[model samples]
Target: MSAPTITFNGTIPQQYDDYLGPFLFEPYALDLADRIDYAPVTNVLELACGTGRLTNLLLERLPSSAQLTATDLNPDMMAVARKRTLAPNVTWAVVDISAIPYEDNQFDLIASQFGFMFVPDKLKALTEIHRVLAPGGKLIFNTWGAIQDNTAWAIVNKVLHAFLGGNPVPQHLGPFSMADAQVVLQALTEAGFHHVNATSVKKTGLAETAAIAAQGFIQGLPFATAIQEKDPSLLPKIQAAVEQEFSAQLGNHPLRTPLHALVFEASK
Candidate 1:
């Protein structure tokens, strides 16, 4: 779903953390956590810590003395994240990234998973991030590439569009908004982040079965929210179609599909 249309409230957070988090977000979460220099970093602010997919890995990489403040726009997501990653060093809060409520230079590093694209005003959010970060602090985040680059999701989107008679919901079209590195780099630069760099990363989106992948797509994302809002009765039909599509195209055993993303790193 498009960033504007996607909202991880209600049951969406739990399903997202359960299905999509492990299949699509975990590898990148691990990679992003691994990039943390860890030696000197003491204060970290994780924006959009959806269900703590990255938080779980990040905790492992951080030194015991490090302080982590995890924030998300949705309280439902924060609740799930809190239960998943319980630690004395971590503080969980619901925060608006556009107007972050923190003292200047409060954090040494800021990180986000596949959430950068969701911000309504990226430069405003980045400016807030820059404001809260200490000198030479870093901002690390990732965004999905074009829809075509992520084949499985792309196919699901295509199927939904075709099934719904080409009037797919905006949530289905939102996540790929910042696919271009140039746009992201410009936003970061304008927000006062220096040495901005965007790197392409590829990972395998894996599920135990085609049914699982299909179910994950249907239930674990904005697809479910959209369907629930407009036509909840059509769920079974959509799920069946998605399963059949995956089985026909990707086969049933140990489903593995490629997903492309751009990892952006900038110094504040």
Candidate 2:
């Protein structure tokens, strides 16, 4: 079985921001933003600033004098982000992490939220990040933990697997690919980042209803495309099953599920 190619196009970007943004991403975005020491950060770069969840928070924390360059590979995602975040000091660009466009040692801080795992070459991306980071600068990012560790996503994955019937899981190839701490640490070290630290952070994922949560998991993510490719007609059935599972396990009318992720911080 082969993983489906994940693209943040069409309505995926808007749906992602509308559904999963607050539920799965906002908590980690707050955590990532809070981890930064913004006193000396004049120039900042954010990679894969999906819908500007963390980018908005970063702007709030940063001083008026600070400049932020937020970039993502998908213009659709960036469009949503740009609409949400409007600041005079912020510059938006379409960027690929593996080959950053900025000059060497340019940014005082580089941050990403739940984006690194999707990079095909982790070491290459980290090296590019290190190159852009100024001397003694910091890099902070987070990756989702193993599927089983994130309770809500774990349940969703199980339901998806059952529906796919022995097909490859879309998330395994992207979001959860770098779940292992050792793998992340090794990549950072090899990329020449020092004083590396990894922290396991767990947060509560909230959704208004089981149905809505199911929609987020099924349609908002790459899973939607995978399911569509396999059998578009099965999407509704799988989503219903996922909703039922969520209601049974997590509850409805303000669903609160445990989500786990690994946060990494390194100095260049």
Candidate 3:
């Protein structure tokens, strides 16, 4: 199917934390953390802080004095994040990125990992970030590259497409939605960001076995939600088909596949 309305609920939060987090998100989370100079950042905000993979890294990397507010639109995801990440310096909130409730110039840095793709109005969301960021503050976010560059995702998409008889359901195709660098840069620049830089990052996602990779793709992310919406009865068949294809192509032992992302950073 195309994609599901991006959601993390019920078992999804746990599954996402267990499989997807390590497979695709942790590397970019660490990359985003390394881009920041935490010594000077006293206040930080993390948008779309799903299950807090990046939040934990930020807590570890930032200065002890720094305070962070982690927010996500999904309460279930935030609940999982709060349970996983415990710190006196952090406050959790359920927030809409386009309409931030904070005061002007409230944050020294705003970091979003694989979240901007879900924003319907990218410019409006960036403007909100720019509004709440202090002068010289930074915004660092990453979006996935085109499907062709992401091996596991591409394989899943192909398999799902074929299984669904070449008619994928209509839903939010999150990562593939924001693949244009020029458009992203323009949105940031228009939102009053300066010194904008876009870099391409490539990482190998490690899976102990192709079955694990297939499980992560089939049951751990929004694609699972899509499968349920389209036809709940097809889940087992889909999972088995994807697992077989992955095992045949990627091998069963220690599957490592390429994933690409476009990391964007700018200062206000």
Candidate 4:
């Protein structure tokens, strides 16, 4: 049997969004927008626009003369994102990067934040991104750098696993790590990007050891369901264990997890 498809609104409880809200969109937008300073941008494309965090930043940096198109595979996510009053500079669409629906050479700049790792066929997605970029266009994007560096996830996953009696964690949920960076870069290179490099953008996790980090991943992602497959009633246990461990680790605030953002910028 297949798993039930998830929606952005239904993925996580509102409580989790409140918990994860501080880290959600603002920082990602600022950084991705900052990376494109090397060239003047006229038209832009953004992929996997989860709740419009990066989209917010892109609009701020884009000149009033420019236009931005933000796309995501999940319409529900896009629907939630559409709420922002984004300076009349953004066009929102539901699109799958694996088969990008755009004419060739349409964008001067294209990017995403925390989006690349989610693609089902990464090579196909890269090819499509490349296809849509105009000559001399740039690709600036990022993914989770390493699991150990992200204390919020590391602690959450660890405690949840212990509650589940030490079951192995699935690879997809913790997809980006140091070991995977080389292959990720290679895939981008194979997809025809030149001058590829991954940069370190680290943030200290503010949530403490005991506080439930937020609703974002604990409730928002399909990962918890994956864990549930091992045990029919793991969801409640996972939630409880994560809450207890986080509370044990954090007393009244968010933990200070050192997170890294592995960034790559290159040209076609």
Candidate models: Cα lDDT each: 0.84, 0.89, 0.86, 0.69
Per-residue lDDT of candidate 3, residues 1-268 (tens digit): 3444567787888888887788899999999888888879999999999999999999999888899999999999888898876688999999999999999999999999988888878789999999999999989999998888997888888888777765253424366777889888998999999999999999998888888778877888766777788889988888898888877777778888889999999999
Instruction: Locate the minimum summed-lDDT window of 10 residues in model 4.
Output: 1-10
lDDT of 1 at 201: 95
Where does candidate 1 stray beyond 4 Å?
1-5, 166-173
Candidate 1 lDDT over 1-268, as tens digits, reads 3222667788878878787777898999988988879898899999989889888788888999999999998899888888876688899998988989999999999999987677777788889899999999988999999889898888888888876654344542367878999998999999899999999998888878888888878887767877876678988788888888888877778787889999999997
Give one clash count per candidate, in the order shown. 5, 0, 0, 18
Using lDDT as the measure, which candidate wins? 2
- By lDDT, highest first, what's the ranking? 2, 3, 1, 4
Error of 4 at 219 (Å): 1.6
* Reference-based lDDT, residue 125, model 1: 87
* lDDT score for candidate 3 against the true structure: 0.86
Instruction: List the candidate numbers ranked by TM-score, top first.
Output: 2, 3, 1, 4
Better of 2 and 3 by lDDT: 2
Model 2 poorest 10 in a row by lDDT: 165-174
